[model samples]
Target: MKKSRYIILLPLFISLTIPVVFALTSKGQMLENFKRQEKEMIFESQTIFLDEGDRNILKTYNKLNVYSSIGDKIQSKREYLEVQNEKINSRVNSLESSIIQFDKDIEELVIEVNKINEQVVSTKDEIDTNKKTIDILQSRIEESTVILLEYIVYLYKKGDYVTTDNDIDNIKSILLSGEKIDELVNDLYFKSIIQLTGQQLIEKHRDFVSRLYVKKLELQESENQLKTLRKQGILERNILDDKRSSKQRILEITKGQEELYQKYISEQLELERDIKVKELKEQIKLNNTKKKLLEKYNCEFVDIQVQQTEFSALDEQCANINKIIFAESRLSGIPLENNPLDWPVNPSLGISSYFNDTGYQRLFGTDHDAIDIMIPMRTEIRAPMDGYVVFIQPVVNTGYAYFAVKHSDGLVSLYGHVNQIDVKLYDFVKKGDVIGLTGGEYGTNGAGLLSTGPHLHFVVYDEEEYNDPLNYLNLSYLSYKSLPSKYQFKYKSDFKSRKGFEYADTSKKQSTSGSTFVIEGENELERQKYLLGTYAVGDFRNWDIWVEESIAGGIDPTFMMCVGLAETSLGKYLKSAYNIGNVGNNDRGDTKDFPNARSAIAAMTSTFNNKYLGKYNTINQLSRYGNKTGAIYASSDFNWHNNITKCMSHVKGEYIPDDYNYRISIK
Candidate 1:
């Protein structure tokens, strides 16, 4: 069980100690030093108390009813912090239990090592006694050997023993004569006694020598056993030291983690407090602002016309209209009869919220007064009609920039959530004139209050009351879907004809005989394939035929593909009838449809080759003329050539120029 616990902690030990080892010393001595440090340091249980003030702050803010998203975010953060704190506490508890177990293990190992030490000392004492006995036995054996040698010498001198045959015969003849029988008997008895004594002494000496050798062997074994016990004791002590070190290291790390978690929890609580306070203050400000806006709307405005002297003092600026290209939609759906106002932005960009949209009441705390036109940040906000700039908020980063245009019809158009404005107050702007860039991305300048995402809030007011801007401008079928069902209108296939742009006559057939098209780079075909695959242009998955045909027709294949992108988003918005480029779209909204993507591509390339490529071979050259595919092909669209050029640069892996001006000469 103890070993299993150590095994479980092995990974933690390595993880905690290895980094310290690397930070302080070389790899060779890192582990050794860590072990030493851990063993030497004393460890105590760490108790980290939660800060009451931090807890109270969180509890106080959490109790208050905050309906804003910020409040919800703070609550979520608090919950996450709580979870983290609980996890930390759990881990600390586990580490403390592990440390306690290690302490117990260390104590056990210490006792075992001491017992081994006692056994080792006892074994050493036995070995010493055995050595002393072996030495005494050796001395006794030497003395016995000397006594036995003296006895042998005395027997030889007394002639009590004989080995020669002549001496034995003489002794026999003397016994027969019976002259010294008694003396012989006496000598024999004394010699036998002396021989017995010597034999006993030799046997005793052999026994002592054998016992001495046995003692010496036993002493060697005892010394070896003592050494083994000492080694075991040392091993136990090492284990005890390792356990102590492990416990100390765990305690130290747990203490540090506890402190860090406490600090983090405190900081999170403080942050929550600050956020709640800020939200409360902003709520008050927003209520006041809303009240003031309501009062302002209720009152009548006196027109303050700017004199020539005052107008000349401010900078006169105009908005850039070419930055945006309106997507294809039914223009006839919009009501334009006797309407001075036009669309402030492309209707196809869609609307997020409408006037008095109840969906917005929860966020704004009131009925939405204006329509929210959904568009990306920095999109150009255009003048809907010929109007004079009546009010302009020029602050760029205060989130309060907006401008109002007073139209001749006594209607006012207010554009809000604007970051950049070009025109000064009292400046006259015609319809479709660019005014400024729209904003509303969160935390960005001009996002103002209650911005969920990027969009333009467009408001209109008559002298009497606030009016829905949708009532004044033409609405497309696409944007019509974004409004409440009451404002939506049924569509008719036979819609009115659209307005047209100036164009040169195309009554005569154009020839492609003079056209000479060139591909841009050596690797352009492969590059175009990669770009098409990257954009997942499905129509061009089998695009080799389209590219070959386009190249054979003396037009850049990339430009042809770009034309496809410009018209249909590379076939995403292609009409179901399979006209990839909307090839023959005109003012009446009629389009030529092919049977397949390849046929469409071929027809588009051929049309470009015959009509436009004969004069303008390159995209730059084609775009150089007024926005009508060099004033011949698709002569109504102002953004056609620009879009194609942009796509050409993009697909060819060239820099897409930000400048939308297509009039500049290409180098």
Candidate 2:
């Protein structure tokens, strides 16, 4: 019956995909694959926790907000602060569990397949031994038959002749033949039974082969399913890795900011609580309220400002406090307060529109309150001075976000269109520490309100009033502005071909061959390591090597540095789809991914030099050449030539030649 069953399933067995050595060789492969997945799971979990640690650190340093109530009275207003990719993580954990189960299943299948293979081998050996015994039995039966026939012949001869002495001997032999025949019959019967048993063993081996074939097919299907799941798991893990990488960079900014803010708050709160200072503030408020400029308890802004429809209740209160403080300072004969500030961003092409630009005035029916400095999306928005964040919120309806920092000098810098806030509220940040990332445009990083594209709306709260950032920074805000691109050309596609622009030739080889990277007997790798030490995350540390490669490709390393800074916000937010320059994503938001950052860098620089070398020898010419057909690099509101030049100057810590592109040496 078992043999019959195997025969019925035989045809299907031929199509089995799993190898016959599944127990020996393929089992090891499955185990190794499972182990690899296990390692990856461990690594990903570690990465996720690393992000949690950073968040916790930020929470610790930022002020903690706690509330207490006694007898139905609540004292709520005190200073302090504080990827839930929970779904992705849960799915990952689940995947790990399933993979573990799959491993166990494969192990069991391996054991079962091995046992069946052993039985088949043993069955085959039994069949071989039985065949030898059957052959030996057949030889004995043949010899016995020959002897019986000889006896029969002798008997016939003796019957035909008279009974002589020879005949008598033959008759005795015939009697002996009968006894031999009996033994031979028994032996032949035993051999027949042995042969039958060997046949059964052959049938049993067929059944074992059929069972192995079925298990192989089953194993193949199961392993394939497991591999598919693993493949998807890998892709999801990579996405989480990218998300984690972005967050890690933000954590670095928070490290400086949160610690500083905590110290500032702790120190300032202690000093302000002194009896004399408290009495002085109370006296000033009391004296100021006696005049018509303020009401007794509400001595902040002008009475008319309180009546204004544009200001929110919170805005009015804040304004009023500033007003009262300013009045007190003035009465005491204090000068209007100010801070010597550098441009928070680059020397912007120019203000997209000044603080309280007309569009805002129309919207709020009041003056615009911030200066819009045009910059790329994800540009690093630095702290204007040493300060702590007092407010951070997402005004989704307004189409952008904003954060406010209270400087120690009684000044405040409010930056808007910021989609990403690295520091929590009350976290202290230094004058030049990156506190957040810039965002604007209707739907780039985050949606924006009246904003058309990426730019920084910078404002200052000084002398109890919102002042122009332009006034403080004193930046060169040229009357005319446009995009900060060397040439203007509409993108036909984001993935432009490097081969299309391979004609730009360099007559002079760069003076140095990666010599600049050999700092203190350390090669480019060592220099990159040192440079990357300042960065919180090491994912992008390898990018520095691309700087060396670009120099070899005949582009200035200085310009490459500036371009990387301007485009990637100093790696704060990388489009991995992009090289340091997001040439892959046109300003219009058409994003295309490259294989990796290094290959993308090589391709972009090669194409850039090929297209622009001879045609636009100088930065200024590149800036002014948009009038020609297909020469549009920047859209509007800034000139790429001037912006990159200024940013390059900032990087070099000095001005470069007016004809920067044409200049042979940075020094």
Each candidate's TM vs. the true structure?
0.26, 0.23
Q: Using TM-score, give the best candidate's number.
A: 1
Q: What is the C-alpha lDDT profile of model 2 across 275-382, one tens digit per residue?
A: 344445545544443342334334445343355543234354445344333332322111233225556787446667666454444344446666788788788888
lDDT of 1 by residue, 234-331 (tens): 78888888888888877776868667667767887787788788767755654454344334334211222434444334332201000000000001
> Which residue runs does candidate 1 get wrong by more than 4 Å?
1-338, 477-483, 490-667
Clashes of each: 1, 21
Residue pairs with colliding backbones in model 1 are 399-446
- RMSD (CA, Å), candidate 1 to true, equals 44.8
